[model samples]
Each structure stands twice: as structure tokens, then as C-alpha cells.
Target: MGELRLMKGNEALAEAAIRAGVDGYFGYPITPQSEVIEYLMSEKPHERTGMVVLQAESEVASINMLYGGGGTGKKVMTSSSSPGISLMQEGLSYLAGAEIPCVVANVVRGGPGLGDIQPAQSDYFQSVKGGGHGDYRLFVIAPASVQEMSDFVPLAFDVAFKYRIPSLIVSDGLIGQMMEKVELFDPIPRLTDEEVIARYPWATNGKPKGKERRILTSLDLDPHKMERHNWALQEKYKLIEENETRFELIGCDDAEYIIVAYGSSSRIAQKSIQLARKKGIKVGLLRLITLWPFPKKPIEEFVKNGIKGFLTVEMSAGQMIEDVKLVVEGRAKVEHFGRYGGVIHSPEEVLEALEQKLIGG
Candidate 1:
């Protein structure tokens, strides 16, 4: 453990990446997250730890660089905002198809097409529901606080390499720009080439003695072979769903209504929960940590345990509400409240929506 420092979220993420012993970082400049690369560049992790940092020509080039580095079993990552992330989708799909392990952070902003650089959760669907083509999923982690922004980078890389899948840190402009006290960790040593080889034998680092050369690709001309690959991916996802679903339950044990949220919305919802509690309304919060391996069973359990209804808060036009409804079925009422296009709802507004939609209704 190192001394606690008040740091911005994007800077914290960069510092943590260096401490986590990431092998490389490639990305273009994007608002609300430019500090990630800026910090890395300023710190010069290459001098300190042999890490490589490069500003790519575009998001497309950045993601491809990630593919090249990840295919070689090096810990690599990139960070971008909404539109910038969209540019990387094709590469992401290819990475998923090829089963490359890497981390991508999306500091979300208002969006439909190059929307404003303000905090928004509008990218919820794109982040969790596969923005690219093909039946693939990114292990999505929504970090609400600046502390979590620092913590989730290494966690994302760990899980990504463990499962050999691409992982996403789904954040918002609010979290990215906000500053908070964070306890930094000591630096971890980067893996040696021999260690990389032992850990990821399938990596295309080099053909070792008596070992076949590994081909890294997503293309399969044979339909049967592609189907088999898809099947394997499906199995991996199943295991992830079973073992990786993560969430935080607050005051749900004795509540009549539940609010579902993630990322910055979760922080707002937490304040709303306090307001509701002060008024003697039994409101609780279910904050999602992992968005893709959505905590479905927990939500289902809440419904089964006789919770009255759910109000899903987001910065989008009710994207995650679909997942909540899918899990709740018709057993309980589910409603949505959002503030989109660079707008954010206050705690008072969220509480009012909860009272009107779930309680008063």
C-alpha cells in the first residue's frame, strides 16, 4: 500500500495501470478520458517499467494495436469516449472472435452521433449488449466512484486474461473528471517472456522448442469450424455468468421498492435512497458492478422475496430497464427514469420519479 492521494479518476486509472504492470497502452485523444493517456505519457511508464504507450492515428488503429499486443499475451488496454469507442467496435468484434484478452475503458458521454462531452450512461446498450457484429459479449464493469475507477483497471485485465475474453470498464464523464481520495498500490512487476509463455501457451509470441506456431485470427472459412468456435464462446459466457455476476445490495433486506442503477446513476440513486429512507419510504438500491454477467439471479430473488416494484435510473432512455424487466417478468412492476443528451438527474428528481412511478402508481 502507498500513501492516499486525491486524484482525478482518469489519472487514477492511468497510475493504476502502471502499478498493475500493463505491458502496453494504445489510444487516441478523447474528451473526458484524455487524462488517462496524458498521465501515462507524463509519467513515462516505459522508463519506469518497460511499458509501451503510443498515441494512435485513430481509434481504429488503437484497437488494432491492442489486438496485436493482446494476441502476443501482453497486458494491454485503451480508453476512449462514446464516439471514439464506437470507432473501435469492429476491432472489438474481431478481438472477441479471436479470443484476445485486453481491457477497454469507456468514459461515457452523451451520444447518438458525436454527442456532447458531458456525463451520460447512453452507451449502456452498446457497452453491454455487444456494440460490434457477431454474437459476442464484453465483460462489462461499471465503476461508480473514482476509487472504483482506479481499482477496476487491474481487475478487468485479470479477469480478461483469466477467461481469454475482452473486458470493458464502463464509466461516465462524471467519474472520469471527478477527483477523490484514493489509496494507491505498489507497482507489480511485469511478466517475463518465459512467464508469459508459461501462462499463455497459446499466445503467438514465438514457436518455442517442439511447440507448434499459434495462429491468432477470427476468420474461419469453414462454417462448421466457426460454429464450433461460437459454441466454445457460449460455454465460456455461461461459466462467467455463473461465477462472475457481481453487485452491491443496499437496504434491500427490508424494502418495498428497489432502484436499479449502475455507474454514475448508481451514485445518484444512492442519494435518492437516503432521501426516500428519511421520508419513511422503504426504498433500497441494487447497484450493478458487472453489467454483462448481469446480477439477474439476485434481481429475481428480490422479486421472489416479495419486493413491490423496481425503478431503473439511467442517463439513457431506459436501456438497462430491459434487463430488469426480463428478470422481473410480470411478477412486479418495473418503470424507467432517465436524463439523456448530456443531462443528469438530481437525487431529488430521482426520488420524485421513484415515488410517482413505483410508489404512487
Candidate 2:
């Protein structure tokens, strides 16, 4: 544990990344997330920790830089908004195929085009559902507040390395721009290059004294080899889903209305739960920490425990609500409430949605 600070989510993420001993950051400037780059620029963390920070010409170049650093078994990261993140998809998929560890933060905004700089969650599906292509997954962490933004950086790195996959801290403009009281933790120490190479010799740094040539690639020309790689990935995914599930349950032990929300929407949902409780609605919250490898079993268990219904709220066009519906499996009614195109709905609006469906219906 280090100290407390009132900071914006974007600033906290950059500061926390530095504290986490990240080896590098490579990202193009995109609103909301640009503060992350600015923080790194202003602090010059490299002077203190010899961390590398480079603002690339494009998202493409940034992700490639991340790829190069990752090839050397170094902790590297980047951030972008929705469209910019979308552009990085090809690199992300290749990284997944190669089993490279990295972190990508998507400070989401309205989508399908050069959407506004305001907050939105339209990237929900893109982030969670193999954004690039070909049977892949990013270890997704959805942070609901500035506090979680600060806390999730080291956790993201740990998970990324533990699973040897790309990890994401998925947030939106509201969380990115808002100021909050956050308690920062002491930077989680990470393995040095020598230590990492000792453990993961496959990393492509350079051939040493008697070591053989090392290659970093994802291509498998033979069908059988590709099939084996896919199977290995499947096993890794299973292990991750089984062991890496994380979420927050509020009054869900025995509640009639369970609200399923994540990221900034979750903060509003939490406030809605408080208000709903005061009004005698037994409302609870299931805040998703791990967006991918979705926390299904616990949610399913709650439905099995006689929870009547759930309100899936987000800033997207009911993207994740579909997953909630699938997991709920008709045992409990699942309804969705959202505002797309960067328009943020207030807590009252969410509570009203809950009132119509959960309270009155």
C-alpha cells in the first residue's frame, strides 16, 4: 500500500502503470485516453524507472511496438479510444495467437465511426468477443471507477503474464475524466528481464553464447500444427475461465432484482441500487470485473437461488445484455437498459428503467 490521491481515472491508470514497473507504453493520442499518454509524457517515468514511453504515429504502429516489446518478454502496454482500438485489432489477434503478454486500455466512446470524445460502452462486444479475428480472447478487466482504474493496472499485468495473453482495462469516458478519491498501492514488483528470460527462454531477445536462434511468430503452415495450437489456446481459455473469474456482488445473496452492469455504467448502477433499496426494492448489483471469460457461473447461481430478474445496463446498444440473457437462461427475466452514441444516462434514468421492469412489472 502506498498512498491516497484524488485523481482522474486516466491519470491514475498512467501513474499506476508506471508504478507497476511497466517496461514501455506505445500509443497514439486519442481523446479520453490521451491523458494516459500525457501523464507519461509529463512525469517522464523513464527517468525514474528507465521505462520506455513512445507516442506512435498511429494505433497500428503503437500495437506493433507493443508486439516487439512483448516478444522480448517485457511488460508493455498501450491505450486508445474505440475506433483507434478497433484499428489495433489485427495486431491484437496476432499477439493472442503468438501467446504474447501485453495490456491494452480502451477508453471507450460512441462507435461505428469517428465517434465523439464523450463516454460510451459500444465497444463491449469488440473488446470481449475477439475483436480482431480467429478464435482469440483478451483478458478483459472492466473498471467502474477512478479507484478501480488505479487498482486494475498491476492486476492487469499479473493476469496478462500469468495467462500469457493480452489483457485489457476497458473503461469509458466518464470514468476516464471523472475525479475520485483513490488509494494507490505500492507498485507490484515484476520479474526482471534476466529472470523472465530464465523462465521463458522462448522469448526472442537475441541469441546468446551458445543459445540457438529464437523466433517470435504465430504462423503455422501445417494444418496439424495449427490445430494443436488452437487446442492449446482452448485449454488456456478454460483454465482462465475456471481460475480467473472475478466480480463484485452487492446484496445479491438474496435479492429480487439483480442489476448486471460494468465499467462506468456499474457506478450508476451501484447508486441506483442504493436508491432502490431505500424505496423498498430488493435490488442488488453484480459488477463485472472480468468482462471476458465472463463470470457466468456465479451469475447463474444467483438466478438459480430464486433471484427474480436482472436489469442489464450499459452505455452500449445492449451488447453484453445478450450474454446476460444467455446465462440467465429464462430462469430469471433479463432486461436491458442503455444509451448508445455517447449519450450518458443518469442514475435516475437507470433507476426508472429498473422501476418499470423490476419494481412494477
Candidate 3:
């Protein structure tokens, strides 16, 4: 631990990027996440760590910049809210197809189209289930607290590089705006160009001595070649599913009901668990940390252990519940409770839903 300080989640993410030794950040400001770039610019990371920070003209340009930087094997990142993220989709698809490593943080606000500046999990489908074209998936991490907002950045980068894939930190506006005590970490040194070349020979850093020139693109006109590429991507996703599913179980040991939620919804579900416990109702929480790899096995195991039912609490109209239903597979009852378009469900409201749907039935 470096030092404990009270900070907003967006600020924590910015500071963590500096400490993570990121080489550059290219992003356009968006609500609930503008603080990330604002903090970076104010801190003048270039003076301290030779980091490059640019306020791109648009989200499209920012994501393309990330694609360029990441193709060179640099640890680059960007942050935006839902609408801006939508603008970056095509670039994100290109990054994925090129197999570049980079981190993206979506401090999501409500949206089908610029719905509100308030917290919402409406983008759950977009984040977890490839928002862009092609058969690809992002390693999505959902942070429920200010502390996690800071912590997941480095973790996202580490995983992104390990697999040569894009990683995403999926947060809500509430977490981004909320202030809480967070313990910062010591700074890590950024890798030099030589180091990056040595580590990732596949990087587009020009042809080295006796090495062939690297090519980075998503275009494959040949049908057979494109099919092979798709197969390879699927294999990578399978490996990630096997090795990278992360989740947190709270009070599940003796509970009869499990509430599945992630990001800000998980925090609210925690309070709901306490409320249910006071009424002698055996309730627990299953907080998903990795949304892309979709922690399915744990839910299956809980069902096997005679867990009664599952209620997915979200800020959207039950996007994640579909995954839960798929995993549960009629082994146990499943339900969804949500408030869409920036309306956050209160603890008592969640408890009421749980009681009415899972316990009462």
C-alpha cells in the first residue's frame, strides 16, 4: 500500500493509470468519466513518467490512437461513458481483430442513446457481449467500488497483454462519482521501446535484425483464411473462459438464495443481503468481477448445492439475467429486478424483490 486517501472513483482510476506505468492515454471527455483525463492532464504525467496524454477530437480518433499505440506494444488506455464508447466500437473491433493489447474503462451512464448522466448497467450487453463487429470478446472487469476502480486498471492491462487482447473496466456512474477511502499503490516504471520489442516480438515495431516485418490488420478477404482466424479467436476465448473467470461470493456458505449482480448493482445487493439477513432470510450475494468470461461454474455449483433460487439485480432491464438463466438451465428458479434509465434500485427495494420473487414463491 502506498497511501490511503479519500478520492472519487474517476480520480482513483486516473492516479492508478499513472502508477501503472501506462505509456499514453488518448480519450475524449464524457460524463462521469471526464475526470479521468482531466486528472491526467492536471497531473502532467509527461513530466513525471514520460506518459503521453492527448485529448482526442472524438472518441473515434481516440480509439484509433489506442489501436496505433497498442500495436506498438505500448500500454495505452482510454476512458469514456456509454455514448462515447458507442463511437469507439468500430475501432474497438479493429483493435480486437488486430490482436492488440490495451485497456479501456467505461464509466457507464444510462443509455440507449444519451439517456442520462446517472448510473446505469444498461451497457451490460454491449460490454460483455462484443459491442462491435466480428466474433470477438473483451476481457471485461466490473468494479463495484472506488477502490476497485483504481485496482482493476493494472489488472486489466496485465490480462490484456497476457492474452494480446483488449480488456475493459466496466463501471457505473455511481462508482465513478462516489468518493471513498482508497489505498494507492507504488508506481511502476513504464517499459521502454527496447523492452517492449524484446517482450512482444509480434509488435509492429519495424523489422528487427533477421526478423520479418510485422503486419497488423483485420482484413482477410480469403474466406478460408477468415474462417481460420475466427476459429483461432474462439479458441482464445475458450482459454480465457477456462482460466480467467473471477467473482466474489458473500455469505453464500449457508444461504438458500443467491442474488447475482455486478458493478454498482453489487454494492446495492450487499446492503440488500444485510436487510434480508435481519429478517432471518438466508440470502447471499454473487458479485461478478469478470463479466466477459461470465462466472458460470460458480452459479452452477451453487445450484448443485441446493441453492433455492437466483435473483439478478441490475440497473438495466435484466440483461445479465439471460446469462444467469442460461447457466441455471432450469435447475433452479431465476428472476430479474431492475430500474432502467438511471434509476438505481435501493437496498430495501432489492430486498422486497428477493422476498417476493425467490423467498415467497
Candidate 4:
């Protein structure tokens, strides 16, 4: 009940970034996500809260800008769609290797290679898996609605700064372009320069006059040192899996089957749950809020309850199904149904797939 207003997903996310005390944003324009920077530009947060919003020359420049700003302990962020995000892979790898904390949001569009501007979940593998070179993982959060589009900006920044790793809000074009009633959160004050330097001792905040020089880089000449660093990164990922994983279960207590999905797909599956229940199917929905950790624990728990099967619905060509199958490990029937390259399935279609794929039709 803080402040109620109706807003598009992209606009709300921009306002949320300002209220979240973001230090700066660096991004280039792209379809389905251009609204993000447009909103920021219209607002002129530089005058409002002293937040710097800049449109970089390209996506590659934007990501490198993130690395530079984040290295100094600033809460920097960026937004892009599929192809724009693809240009950022190398920069993302550099940020991870340096342990710089920042947030990147991908309002996904259909693509293996510049496929379409329409909403699609085809970036599932890139978001969750290591899209760039080397051993690393992004803390991936999937927001299902416009409300989440507003709510998760600060949440992503908090998690990013907490773990000192890159965090991504992996939303789709549907959520980015949709409009809905949302209650906005109260604004938080931006951290002072002194506060930032003090809070992150590792940050290269001008070396603090008399303090020891701090250098932030991803390069290591020694093989043994690099090996140790890689091991440390894995241990950090394990800690995130243990601590920051999130998901939601609905009507699951008495369900005979479950529909596993995330982002916009989860929103569709929720209604499909109602349709399945209307027909006395006794099905439930498992909405994954965190994509990287995969929520294996809940799926494994449902398996123990003797659930008949799990149907994973996505807007991709069976990418996430691999994880679902790996988790199920043949203990139950797991199958996938999807409409890729910019096609969105209806609730009836999802229910039909559920009945066919998991209900043994």
C-alpha cells in the first residue's frame, strides 16, 4: 500500500531503478527494451536524484562501462534484448572474473541469430548456463508480472552487491511491454561516496590516500593462482545455490501432476492450472523464480510425494527441459512443450500439452 499506480513493465523497472538508489545506468537501445532507456531519459534522473543515465555507443561499450563503474563500488546496471545481450558476453565474463557486482536485465526476444523482436524465452541457456568463456554463473531471477518487474530491480541489485557477482533479471518481452496496476516501493537514499568506499573495502575507490593500493583485474599469469581463483568462484556459486534460490508452489499439496515453468510462461501456466483443475486433473504449478539454481530441491521433493509427471512449458526449443529431466532422473515422466521463434501458447494449448505430455494422453 505504499503508492498505487498503473505502469508498463519497462517504465516501472526504470522508476524502480531510480528509487533503488542506482548510481548509474549504461545501455544502448534495442526493440522490446528500448522503453527502459526512453523512460530513464524522459525522467532525467541526473537532475532528480543525481543518478547518471547514459546511452552508450553500443552494447559492448555499455557492458564495459558497467565493469568500470561497478569496480569502483557503484551500483551500476544495464538493460538489453537478445542480440544486444549477446554482444555483452565477453564483458560479462570480465566482470565475473573481477568479482564486480552489477545488475543486467534482458527483456528477451526470439533469437538464435537475430530471430525476431517478439517476446520469447529462447535465452534460457544463455542466462542460466555459462554464456561466456570460463567457469562462472549469473544469479538469474525471473519476474513473472509487471509487479515483479518493479519489485525485482532492487532485489537484483541487493543480491548482486551482496554476493559481489553479476545478477540478471531475465524477463521476457511480454513482461517488458505489458501494463498492470502496481504498488511502488518507498525510495531508498543513494549511498554516499564515502559510504561506498567504506562498505566495499575491495573497491578501487581512489585507494584512499594512505591505504594499500587495490587493483581490480581478471588477469592472472600464474596457472596455480588462476586455478585457485576458479575454485573460489565455484564455491561462491554453491553458496548462492544454498542461500539465494527462490520459487513458488501453488495448489501442489494435492496435485497429481505439476507444470514447471518460469517468467511469462509461469503466468500462463497458472491459468492453465485452473483449467486443468476444472477438468478434475488435480494438477499444480511450480513457478521458478530463480533460474540458475534450478530449484532442484522442490522438484525432488515433489517426486518423493509420488507425483505422476512434470510438464515443462517454455517459449523455447526444449532448453530448460534438459535441467528438469536431469533433476527428475527418470523417477517420473518429464516432458516439454513449447512454441518458439515468437509464438505464445494459449492456456488451452498449455493444458492440452499437459494432458498429452504428462497425463499420459
What lDDT would candidate 4 get against the real structure? 0.92
Estimate, for each residue in 137-248, the C-alpha lDDT of model 1 and write its tens digit: 9999999888898888888988899899999999989999999999887788999988999899879998888877799999999999999999999999999999888999
Could you give candidate 3's per-residue lDDT for residues 210-292 as a string of tens digits? 87778999998999999999899899999999999999999999999999999999999999999899999999999999999
TM-score of each: 0.99, 0.97, 0.99, 0.99
Tens digit of per-residue lDDT, candidate 4, span 1-361? 6899888899999999999999999999998999999999999998888999999999999999999999999999999999999999999999999999999999999988988988999999999887899888999999999999999999999888888999999998999999998899999888999999889999987966677999888899999999999999999999999999899999999999989999999999999999888899999899999998789999999998888999999999888989988988999999888898988888999999988777765
Q: Could you tell me which residue pairs clash in candidate 2?
A: none
Higher-scoring candidate on TM-score, 1 or 2: 1
Q: Number of backbone collisions per candidate, in order?
A: 0, 0, 0, 0
Q: What value does the lDDT take at residue 277 in candidate 1?
A: 96
Local distance difference test values of all predictions, in order: 0.93, 0.89, 0.93, 0.92
Q: Model 3 Cα displacement at 74 (Å)?
A: 0.5
TM-score of 4: 0.99
Give the least accurate 10-residue stretch of model 4, judged by summed lDDT: 352-361
lDDT of 1: 0.93
**Superposed model 1: Cα runs more than 4 Å off:** none
lDDT of 2 by residue, 223-255 (tens): 898999999999999999999989998787658
Instruction: Let me know the TM-score candidate 2 reaches against the reference structure.
Output: 0.97
